[model samples]
Target: MRSTLMDIAREAGVSTATVDRVLNNREGVRERTRQAVLETARKLGYVTPPDEEGGNANAPVRLDFVLPAGTNTFIANLLDQLVTQAGAQDGMDVHVHSIEGFNPDSLARQLDALTGTTQGVGVLALDHPTVREAMRKLAASGVPIVTLVSDILHVPRLGYVGIDNRAAGRLAGYLLGRLLGKGAKRKIALFAGSLSYRGHEEREMGFRHVIAEEFQDLEVVELREIRDDRQRAFEETAALLKRHPDLSGIYNIGAGNAGIGQALQEAGFAQSVIFVGHELTERTKRFLLDGTMDAVIDQNPRVEAREALAMLKNTVLGRRFDYHPPRLQVIFRENIPEF
Candidate 1:
């Protein structure tokens, strides 16, 4: 015999009327109660109409995005684009959560919490063991996962939506090398948000590879962590300048461009030091214009947001999606586009 509302209600310890509300997507249902009712229904083979699963007949699918909270202009821009684009699409229901700091434990907890609430997930991954384990669990439980900006390896992610980070890093290295010239020996500083991020680690590797192979004269004297905070970046840069007064170049593997630029200006090395970094923001634009920054290797966040959303939605609906990596664009002062 087929299951009824009364059966689900009794099994879930809720009234039939409560079950009705949950099944029909009515309000006043507590999240825990709703989860209980839904789980009991599924367990008892109480099939609901396709449209009624998430909400009303025309309800949209829910997708959650996990991103960094306090720092990084590029991430903030990506979050804005995701919200705007998701709002425009009637079929997409987007929720965004920003993690305060680079804590893998906190990120893992957030991912674990989304198991029952969202149909799909897109995350700016922190490549740590705990976070990767959480992703594995989510994938095993049938929620489709897609990585944005950075990726976690050896996991079942639908796709990664971003530029080729290795190539971008190599390009930055080459640019810095050419700007500094091959004739003279010089010192360079490298900054990273965190090596726990796969993209950052890969960029550092690529940059080092290029510097070693092509620009042997340029020595990477310091490798520092900025945590993507402007203040932290400023302190690190200031200390670097004091230690190595002849710091000829800098390649930031991630964000925090504003802090580094400010530090350079205060130390009177803005024009002398060749600064190259990632992302093109309002602050970076000003730096490039004033000759404080040489070049910026950028990826289109709009395209990344679109591709990630499409990948999640397609996976949820059992459809196929094409993964097109965003092209890397080198932004110079002459070709800086107006926002």
Candidate 2:
């Protein structure tokens, strides 16, 4: 017997309406769920029926990816990979809309404009109240938004595709504490992208929590938000180093580790302090090899982009997804991927 819509829906664990949306190429489904439905359909020998009016058989799947714009090579590279992956997929069309920097008002405006045009949205956004309100409005407009890299709290996002940020931060703290040992009286500084990014903030909290509870001897200095600018990061690190000459460690929860490294090197303290940061970018990788950066917590950008696209597909197609826990990778000098 041929597989029916109901059968596909049952297998995919989504509503029949969702299945219909997927079949008819309508929007409003979560990307992950849409991928699940389609995968299930294909497994069950389900095929989309041809249009009766001899319309285009292949209806394009439209997805909008919204991201913060800056000179951050990691995010830019990830978006490039996402675009390539999306383009390679058959019967799918993806559009990318980048918000110029991390402005809440600008991001909201971009979101508002994409509401009607995009089937679904994938966002790497700050967790500001204004941003949350924009997401709420987008959800109300029948557009499912997926949070990428950073999470927006209490919003009706379809799903989040990134590492457990708090866990990553905790791992950093654990490593730092172990390396520094007890009664060290070492000072550890935290560098963040912006207080706006929920992921960075969560990382800071996790790092602080572990350091305080487990490693009480180590003193955590104030966290500095660098506005996601390399120059600013450099300046901030220089200022911190000048102020705290006895600093023993630095935790960077942002994308300016290279700048931090440079500042440290210029201050002649590169080899004196233990350094850890997020993301395994090219610069960070090189730093790791040269013994500048001790360790990096890598959130696989390729995997993130792939998952985001897959989730967009599922949401648009009204399909279900197999629940998979996101994984975090610890990149050290020995395990960094070659670019």
Candidate 3:
């Protein structure tokens, strides 16, 4: 007697619907399950469907979204968006990993381990020699990587999904100079989470370049690294006020705006100093409302998350997608977003 689909289902320990799908080369069946059904049919002298030879076309592309462990509101929100998007996509399985302590060595290890299995990865990169080299090697070995807010140049990543950091910095400088006025020479302070962050460095370059070309009178006294810690930011801002009593402006290139705002408030310089920072977090929003923070340069993380996913999906599917850079927002008190 000729073997039937029911024979394959019962012998292979699967439902009749599953055996039917595998026999007819339909999707929604896992590779292992399909293979098992195929092997069972062969043993039972059942004719295998010719369509099954091409393999599963609708298999989920397994991916990993690597995020740094931090309290940066923008990054935190970006991770959330990516997870939500992954859950909604039928053809993708995404696992979000937040590396503890953000040690590049640890990140590289995790990435190297995923080389064989993962289809693609999206990273909020830190600019370090080993980290860049590891990513480059991974991409060379067939795994594609895309950098998010903080990018790296060493690796030929699928693309970067963030604002033009230099332009953002230039805008900050322009706002600072405009708000500071041209009547008198004033000192400016630059605060960043770390100079090692390519985003921060790029912003600093653009800010300084613009300040030099357009507002020569506004002196940039120093670039302070507060490690993205609120206490450090508060201490640094307070120290900056003490050191540069005549400081007219401050531009923060990273998180910890809460500390920046509080320090300015306690020092009795909140209204006097022109304060500009990055991201539109609740902390910054409150500062903007209370007149502590004058301006915010927001790099929309939600938009970035969507863009990254679209671009990466195309890459995985071996297709092309248009790469459009997102415009950085220069927000003020009156233009605060409803969200």
Best by lDDT: 1
For candidate 1, which ten residues in a row score worst on lDDT?
A: 48-57
lDDT of 1 at 172: 92
TM-score of candidate 2 versus the correct structure, residues matched by position = 0.83
What would the per-residue lDDT of candidate 1 be over residues 214-333, giving only the tens digit for each residue? 999999999998999999999999999999998899999999999999999999999999999999999999999999999999898899998888878765553445667789999999
- TM per prediction: 0.84, 0.83, 0.81
In order of TM-score, best first, we have 1, 2, 3
Global lDDT of model 3: 0.82
lDDT of 3 by residue, 115-167 (tens): 77777789877788878888876775556688988889857576688998988
Q: Write the per-residue lDDT of candidate 2 for residues 81-188, one digit (tens) a residue.
A: 889999888867888887876798898888888876777899999777888899887876656778998888788677788888889989999988887777847788
Q: Where does model 2 exceed 4 Å of error?
A: 1-57, 323-325
Give each model's clash number: 0, 12, 0
- Please give the CA lDDT of all the candidate structures: 0.87, 0.82, 0.82
